[model samples]
Target: MRIIHLLVIGALVFAAAYVYRIKMDSTARTERVLRLHAEIREQRDAIAVLRSEWAKLDAPLRLQGLAERHLPLKPLNATQYDSLKNLPERPPSLVRPGDPDPIGAMIQTIDASADASSVTGSVPTSAPASEGQQ
Candidate 1:
């Protein structure tokens, strides 16, 4: 009967320890969650501040004032436009007929090089040195 009582007491102690450990773990997790929430709030506040600053910098009146101060004057008039028929004819294409495209050839060369570089498991590996070379 005394042995059984001792065993019961040991079990109770173990149960208490396990519950305490669980509670401590949950408390740590709760603290971490609270920290993350605070960090998120700080980041949100920073974002709001940045957005407000950007809004101030991007105000149209400020941009217009800067442009007026720095840029050369320009105002369009109807007289500036010309009839489409008066426009010069389109220039001839630079690529001659029946010739392989230079850009395409270069692209093909690069693609071939890429394929070679991608063959990591193939014959491109350096062979083992011979006994004399060692």
Candidate 2:
């Protein structure tokens, strides 16, 4: 064969191989996209099922029925309420108005005491000997 014919044949083979690679890559990507879509559909179906279950669980009538069956709740009577004068006096505050916050003071003391100024075992001053060296 002549040099020109051989070069053309080689170029044709290269082009065919390149086209085949591209086709395979596209097919793989298409299959991946289809798989992802199937996964998304399944997830959406699962979400729908979960939402329906939640709706059933959270229904007011269901909760009310459960409460009625399980809770020993009594109906209110007029005697349950009392005049404002009959109520107990409010207790005095444990913390004074001008006192520094006790919790804040404790937190500050803890932070000051925690000596994290330096770290140990973070790095070695010298490399350890290997097994062969030993």
Candidate 3:
């Protein structure tokens, strides 16, 4: 009977200890959850405050005044805007057939001859004075 009583006491002590350990673990988890919730709330509030401050800093009137102070710009009146709507069309010049520009053609010929002479080690004659003058 005494051995049975000791066994019952040991079981009761173990149960009490298990309950104490479980309570401690649950309390630690609850504290961690509460801390995370508080951090989330703080971050949310900070974002809202930053958004409100950004909106105030980006107001349109302030932006226009800033532009006027820094840029070479002015508010457009209707008369100035109307002038762009009625400009006359310019007629294109006609190019005559077989009428290549003589000076440009001579320059291209001279450049080609220079390249050929440089590779072949000989001097190429330039267009004579008569051809040049024409």
Q: After superposition, how far is residue 115 of candidate 1 from its true place, in Å?
A: 34
**Residue pairs whose backbone atoms clash in candidate 1:** none
Ranking by lDDT: 1, 2, 3
lDDT (0 to 1) per candidate: 0.83, 0.81, 0.79
lDDT of 1: 0.83
Q: Write one digit per residue (lDDT tens) for candidate 2, span 11-64.
A: 999999999999999999999999999999999999999999999999999999
| Residue 1 Cα positional deviation in candidate 3, in Å, after optimal superposition | 1.8
The 10 consecutive residues of candidate 3 with the worst lDDT sum are 120-129
- True-vs-predicted CA distance for residue 122, candidate 3, Å: 69
Write down the lDDT that model 3 would get: 0.79
The model with the greater lDDT, 1 or 3, is 1
Output the lDDT of residue 132, model 2.
21
Q: What is the lDDT of residue 68 in candidate 3?
A: 84
Tens-place lDDT per residue, model 1, 51-117, is 9999999999999999999999799899999999999999997888876677767755664567555
Q: What are the per-residue Cα lDDT tens digits for candidate 3 across 1-75?
A: 999999999999999999999999999999999999999999999999999989988999988888989999967
Give TM per candidate.
Answer: 0.62, 0.63, 0.52
Return the clash pairs for model 3, or none: none
Which numbered prediction scores highest in TM-score against the true structure? 2
Off by over 4 Å in 3: 75-134
**Candidate 3, TM-score vs. the true structure?**
0.52
